[model samples]
Target: MRRINGGGVIEETCPSWCAGDHQDDQATDLDDLAHSSTVTALQMRVNAAAPSPLLSAAILQSPYEDVTSERVTPRAPYVVFAPSDDDFTIELDADGLADVIAQIRQHADRLVQVRNQLMALRTGMKGTAAMSDGL
Candidate 1:
């Protein structure tokens, strides 16, 4: 993506039949997405890169639904918790990690206070043991 007029621009080659000096009018409106930049650039890149033979074979072996449907859209400052056969991962953005750490520390402080209360109760019970032994 190249910056032009303080925003990103993606340029692509058009086929001769699709070419015109002022062909911006041929665009279809897709909501929220900048159609001229994002969608057309993706199509152009996919068309330009020929798939490897092994990749093509693997895609064929996979389910048909896998080819037609993909719903993952990634953004900055996100998390991905992925688990596999042998391993798992919990990936978080820097700010998210900081927030988690803060929450853990806050809970840890409460846990320490509860533990001290339990210890104090045990000490009070031990005084009864000392008195019984004296009697």
Candidate 2:
């Protein structure tokens, strides 16, 4: 694909999941020349609250390659997580992402346990109320 800023042809092939070219030709900085894949929307909610905000997940690749610098180098494509509100972003590699998934599973399991306990409490309250009505 062609770089918008007259950088010439892009040699790398787009990832399978990439929707389209996101390279900004008019980008004034190298950081803005990064390529991004189509974002996958993760509908996340806290405590079962309404109006769940969407979390955007995508794979990103840096624009430049084969540069030896103390501050930067050619980096492998990595996943980026961001909120729909565009507040902040977190980037992670495969192993880091796996850790995040594990943590989420642990939290989800805890939530399930709490839900079961709440259900039991409600059930017991219902039985007590029924007996009180007979009194």
Candidate 3:
């Protein structure tokens, strides 16, 4: 048998089966009704074209837009961008070029070190091979 509570349908065995030895448990009936409604709603949502509310919004945000720039010519002599006021028009001399290369190599080495430390903390550095000496 079914009865309406809070605009939801609650299912129960015949009242005769629940009388004398059993009485209507309002709490249990309400919980079952609520659970049934929730499951039905979730199933409907899953079958819909747009399941979760965030799915459509996330889809709309993709396909990044293009931006125009003044200085970034297709064929600039060097990758020229002044990061700060103190370092404008920094051209790559032999030493400066070497320094830049070494800085990049050092940054990569540091990343590996940090990754190794993280692995050690996370999984006791299990099966991690030692970094090669030759770069």
In order, candidate lDDTs are 0.39, 0.67, 0.35
**Which 10-residue window in model 1 sums to the lowest lDDT?**
55-64
Question: The CA-based lDDT of model 2 is what?
Answer: 0.67
| Candidate that beats the other on TM-score, 1 or 2, i.e. the better one | 2
Give the per-residue lDDT digits (tens) of candidate 1, residues 21-135. 4243223221122211111111113466763221010001111123233323222223332222223445545565567568768987999999999999999899989999999
lDDT of 2 at 131: 96
Best by TM-score: 2
Which residue pairs collide, candidate 1?
none
In model 1, the runs with Cα more than 4 Å from the true position are: 1-91
- Which of 1 and 2 is the better model by lDDT? 2
lDDT by residue for model 3 over 1-135, one digit each (tens)?
344355554444432211122234343334332111111112124554654321010001101112242323211222222223233434333455467568768987999999998977766434333333333
* Residues 11-105, model 2: lDDT tens digits: 45556765655544343433445567877776666786764546667887765634553323355677887756466877777887787778768
Q: Tell how far residue 123 is off in model 3, in angstroms.
A: 0.2
Ranking by TM-score: 2, 1, 3
> What TM-score against the true fold does each predicted structure earn?
0.35, 0.70, 0.27
Clashes of each: 0, 2, 0
- The positional error of residue 60 in candidate 2, measured at the CA in angstroms, is 1.1
In model 2, what lDDT does residue 17 have?
A: 60
Task: Give the Å error, residue 9, model 3.
Answer: 87
